[model samples]
Target: MGKLDLVMFEEEFTQLQEIIGRLQVDSSSKVVFLVDKNGQQIAASGDLRSIDATSLASLTAGNVAATDGLAKLIGEKEFSLLFHEGEKDNLHISIVGKRGILVVLFDHNSSLALVRLRVKKASRELQEIFEMVEKRAQSQSGESSKFESPFSEITDEDIDKLFGD
Candidate 1:
């Protein structure tokens, strides 16, 4: 999973957290989490005590990446949504704005149709927030050269040595 370039401000972060929290309740889910493509947990709400969030985020990102590969192989763009049903639980994962992955965990109490409906609305709102975050990041990066290059310290000598020149 590659890192996402969008820089989220505190305001946007808080807003997104709230949205995730609301989605958990509205969807009657056990947990609702927002993760970046890089497997970084942006915001999560609900019962997280039993779950290892770090693992969940990383694995979820990997799952999305694999699903995307499958999609391309079938002459499709990408599988924007995924669902996994377990014996006791189910997961609904959706890609938001091509930046964040929203995961909702539910059980028999919630129907897939209802979760999909709620997710559709929440995804739109999340997409808007992500767009704002991207614009802000672009403006900030534009003002400074720091964000432009991660290896700015590398010199001609370094490259020559790397190539055994």
Candidate 2:
């Protein structure tokens, strides 16, 4: 399998944050977070202190992967969206491009229909930003071919020195 590398430049990050911000307001969601397919969080907005963002991102990706596998076994291409409704809060999870996932958490303040509508718009914007970042990373990779790996110069002595008393 090819390695997965996502490069988020400052401009791209800013745009992504704006998208999440808009979604949060439009959908009335308590939290909105973007996660890559590999479980790395790109951006988030809303009440982040109430929950563990990293754990949520990781679990969301795993949930998508499990649903995708289930779809394949049943002869479907893939399930692009998954919804989980709770007593007080609900989750709207959707795929962004093939390599990213968008997650929204909302309470009774927002209706599912509205969340879906706003998420649809945000997903399109995020996908475009992600594509731009991917292309830039690809182009930059070629230009950095002359740089040597920093780890190559590190020896066992260097490791031991850092830990020594």
Candidate 3:
């Protein structure tokens, strides 16, 4: 729940929100949300003002992680998307590269086919955006100096106890 002050988060968030605006849906249930892989909301649009975007983001991440873990248990690499259809609502999920998940919530009136198509198209663009951020991260990491003895005196047993393993 720490503040999302990470570099490039704002730029990426703004770009994706614009793409979400292109879909066009009802105001009540049609909301587009972007959450990190760890389930932090980077940006959102539509009728999410009352919603806790951060909690929703975290839950979405857990759902994706659970699905991916289940896939691995069954001998699959990873999952890219998940779609759920209910009587009055539908959920569309897309994995945004290695960094995050895009979750769209809408009802029966919204065209599933169109949503899928748009999500697929946007996923690639999101991937490219994330790659640039990663390159920046690598570049920044390269610029920093690694500490040699910040915690060198801490014993393994003490660390294990701290971790409570």
Each candidate's lDDT (Cα)?
A: 0.90, 0.90, 0.75
Per-residue CA lDDT of model 3 for 35-110, tens digit only, reads 8888778777787776778888888999999999998999998888898888887888888887778898888656
Residue 64 local lDDT, model 2: 94
Candidate RMSDs in Å, in order, are: 6.1, 2.8, 7.5
Per-residue lDDT for 49 in model 2? 92
Q: List residue ranges in candidate 2 displaced over 4 A.
A: 145-165
Q: Between candidates 1 and 3, name the one with more favorable TM-score.
A: 1
Tens digits of per-residue lDDT for model 1, 11-115: 999999989898999999999999998788999999999999999999999999999999999999999999999999999999999679999999988989989
Q: Which regions in candidate 1 have their CA more than 4 angstroms from the true location? A: 1-4, 145-165
Q: Write the per-residue lDDT of candidate 2 for residues 3-115, one digit (tens) a residue.
A: 64665667889999999999999999999999988888989999999999999999999999999999999999899999999999999999998788999999999999999
TM-score of each: 0.84, 0.87, 0.75
Total clashes in model 2, counting residue pairs 3 or more apart in sequence or in different chains: 0
Minimal lDDT window, size 10, model 2: 143-152
Roughly what TM-score does model 2 have, to 2 decimal places? 0.87
